[model samples]
Target chain A: MNNVYLYNDSFNELISLIFYLLKNNIKPTNIKDVSYNPNLFEECIFLGIKSKEQDINNIALQFGYYAFRCIYYVYLSNNESKELIIYYFILNAIKYRKKITYMRNLKCVHETLRIAEYVSHETHKMKGFTRFKEINNNILYAEIEPVNNILELVSKHFEKRLKNEYWIIKDVQRRLFSVYDKKNFYIIPEENLKLEDFRISKEEKEIKEMWQLFYKTIGIKERKNDRCRMNFMPKRYWKYLIEMEDEL
Target chain B: MELKEKLKILADSAKYDASCSSSGSNRTSKNGLGNTAIAGICHSFASDGRCISLLKILMTNCCIFDCKYCLNRKSNNIKRAIFTPEEICEITINFYRRNYIEGLFLSSGIIKSPDYTMELMIKTITLLRNKYHFGGYIHAKAIPGASEILLRKLGSLVDRLSANIELPTENGLKLLAPNKDSNKVDKIMSYVKEKQNRKFVPAGQSTQMIIGATKESDLDIMSKSSSMYDNYKLKRVFYSAYIPINKDNLLPTLEKPPLVRENRLYQADWLLRYYNFKVNDLLNENNPNFNILVDPKTDWALRNIELFPKEINKCSYYDLLKIPGIGVKSAQRILKARRNFTITFDELKKLGVVLKRAKYFITCNGKYFMSSSYFKKEFIEANIVLEDKSIENTKIEQLGLFNE
Candidate 1:
């Protein structure tokens, strides 16, 4: 009989599930994490079987820092088999210690790394791609639809950088907003939520218009390549760009 | 004037400068607004597909000198605009907060004098760094012939400093930008390099050269870049293809920019910095220009066919890097994987080697995956470059089947 695990895709639940699987020594055939669902599994497991957070953290750290970070990043990804990939990745890591990360030739570690790179690449791009506009006078607000669940990952980046300012980086697809004041940030996951409409400040409009002008004029006329442009900043992410909205 | 009008004039003036690098300095934000990364980040790609990592703008378009190729030359019939210290600070802080830019790339034309212009730039950046508590990346150009005291003061504040070389040849600078001399530029670069122990410009210095305007060959450009790297230990030597603005007798009579030559120069530049290559490795007096059809690496590989069919299992990392298809990352991957077991053709491809280009040069163990026809110099010469590798891969598979 095949053992399958399902979770609501939280890291805490993932740790508990990992602890439960290891304690019982039940090899899982499939994991219904994020976008995955398989019909071949015979038994199901949810987040009820508890494991200490400290235990999971300690075990994760033993597998090397990069490998452990990859597990967390893999959890943030929307990949279907991320849970299973991490399960195999952690098993090999514990079985061999730091040796598994160097063995990129392994199928399990390779796929997890590919997912980690994808999620990290998105986070890096969104750092530069997030556009903010002043809604009232001073509150800077931006809306994004990233491919992965990276709202929490990027929250630290903004928190470290934008201190002493009121700012909100909202991931519209996840209905999550990381709001930061002068001191700290709060992540709000509202149910059935839509961003409220407000009048754009005149100074904000003027600033964005200036930025749009710079974006258009800065490019060389002789070497215009929209395909290259799309490769880096695809049209799917254009909804958030104030410069692209001028075309509408 | 309105801020929009100033930005239009200043950005148009600053567009000719090709230095957009924001890497190399990993400055941390000390409870401030932004941080710099050693591995650079591209915020967005403009229409030309060039990465717009920073908000590049000139503090002023008003100038005293009449450089023949410049848009903001004093002789040109153009509107002049200058941003106040407050205005520049406002733009940097606001744009950075929106995450539209990595940081600021502030260059300028000489307004009243080099000292006066440098003072204004210093005032603006100091305000941004101190009062605003900004720890973001700042690349400021050191005005040639500025007082050493003023230069040292300016350097202490920004992350990176640069002195524009403008053109390759000394004669090119004398003829076009008459007032500016090569020696003055070198003096500023030396000052920045020598004074780094004082924490002045912690990211080091870089220079830019405008190509296609002068009668300098590719040999001249590469030779200068090599010397600049060796003598000054420069971080980068940027090559900007001359775009005719206010065309004059000294400038090239071109309808558009010579972008391909500029691109080739960049490729050759990369070989010098990362690949541990000298100038003569790719070019000499007879071979002044690179083959426009293929890149510099393939061009080198073709000339020295005796070096090829290097064994994947035993070749050194540097030799592997010299192959046309293998890059720094792939070569390192080969070294790392070889410690476990001998790397095969399948493993080589997985390690990110472009087997299409590398197939002519590399072999797996004792066996060459390429056919005997591919070994011939004439045959490989005829097919050294293809338009795109995707289409060429299909052709190669069919050819492989026939050969088998």
Candidate 2:
């Protein structure tokens, strides 16, 4: 009879590498009964694969990090080719070792800075564009669906300015919220929840009234610069601003 | 008096102030009601499209000085309202508890005298801090003629302080805002700096200068900003592109102030802060203004093509920053990613570098590559045509992508 070893294809390469070092006398074991033994392998590999459908998604995260780092280097150098170079570098670095600090000495740092500058620039633009609405629970709830992963970036600015308050900034597209409680910051995934029915407090009503009054009072009757106002604060953001609610 | 009437009068008075930023300071709560988490927040927007993070209102709209440019100038016919220290504290606390505002940004029009107005503003902030225990950010305007002692007192209470320069040039100030002395404004800014250095204004000081109202060129504005940053240690020097609110003979009677020019100044300002560029580099004796077509960095790159194709692997961080489309974050990322691998042009595209603008300025491995020819004259012409075509097409496209 021929001795054959059966293992899950997902773990085949890792198991094959492990099997090469197994004791010669140990045999006759079912693959289903095989358990990962940290002591058996000289190097331990942890693979995070969810369901079959999520396997690609899990792998893509590692690739996304590589792509992000590559683009960042390209942007820093003001050089366009540094990105491609960084991509190959990431692939090679992953194969060689877990640490990639050696890549910093490779001359691509300049280009990565250029890319970081671009990302920060877009994040700044979105900071001005993001809008918040007052919900009934005394929570200043703002819902933004930015094209980029900018929730962490934008939330930092708001958290500083609104220091003494409790607020929840929800990125509806990403299904995540940065909840602040005057002391600490928590980023949590919001389950399937509809925010439309959230209520506002009585205190909020009086404050909104005061805010609307203040907005109306500030503009000079004789010197209304609709063009300049529109130029800085566009009509698209009016829907979320308290004063523009009537127009919306 | 009715709260509504007072709010209208005070808010109307503050409309001219262009510094709407709610950033920089990070104040948190221990057992108090509020916190400043380092990330700023915007509660709402106004009719003029400015963010309303705080209930940014004046303590009073009544003025003693007859500055010709201000809507609240003593001679101007407008309704006046004054909020007492108690009134301000009440409003700030109420609005803050309800999450209507992040904090208070209190400015005033000299009600009786400069000392009197400064004292009132200071008292309001002190009450909010000591009595009310309000820990939220407060940005107060430093009255130009106020004493150093009072300025220091107010600076300690508020998170940020600003004294409006009002005009870029001394001659401009003399002509438009007659009551304001340019030297006095400078003295107040210097005092703010002296105190800030001595640990008075911890969040730093900011100032606003009106553009286009006076005959100060872009060169004059950049020079003033550069000097302000160097001498005063100002956090920011805001540019409020002058819009002719009142038809004064001294002010320019244009249909609109140059919004694009104001935008360009901000771009140039960012370059000064983050890119290690100087005011002289942005504008020289011949070209005293930023180019209207492209951004300042791009304009600089096109004129000084000798600096182009900087070797990605060999250039220092400072040299890399000079390239068009490359900014502070991208520079830092490149420095981090270049360690483990050799970077190529295709990878840079994925990193979000503006290839269109950067391709002309950088090279990898002694090789220059771009989608089009690297010749300056042809590239500019092609880019202009492409931009013009895109602008024409965008007019017909629906703008729902930006809608909330």
Q: What TM-score do all the candidates reach, one by one?
A: 0.92, 0.72
Best by TM-score: 1
DockQ for the candidates, in order: 0.51, 0.20
C-alpha-based local distance difference test score of model 1: 0.82
* Candidate 1 docking classification: medium
Question: Can you write out model 2's per-residue Cα lDDT over A1-248, one digit (the tens) per residue?
Answer: 32223233332232232233232333322222124342332333322222243423332354455544444323233233332444334344444433443344433433444455555655665555554546756567777765555677777766664656677887777799888887666777887444567786555667777766776766544444454466555565455566666656
Per-residue lDDT for A216 in model 2? 71
The lDDT for every candidate, in the order shown, is 0.82, 0.68
List where candidate 1 sits over 4 angstroms from the true fold: A19-25, A34-43, A58-61, A192-202, B387-404
User: What are the per-residue Cα lDDT tens digits for candidate 1 across B46-145?
Assistant: 7788889888999988888888988888898988889999998998888888888889999888987899999999999999999988888899988887
Which residues of candidate 2, in runs, are more than 4 Å off? A1-203, A215-244, B44-50, B197-199, B371-373, B381-389, B392-404
List of chain B TM-scores, one per candidate: 0.94, 0.92
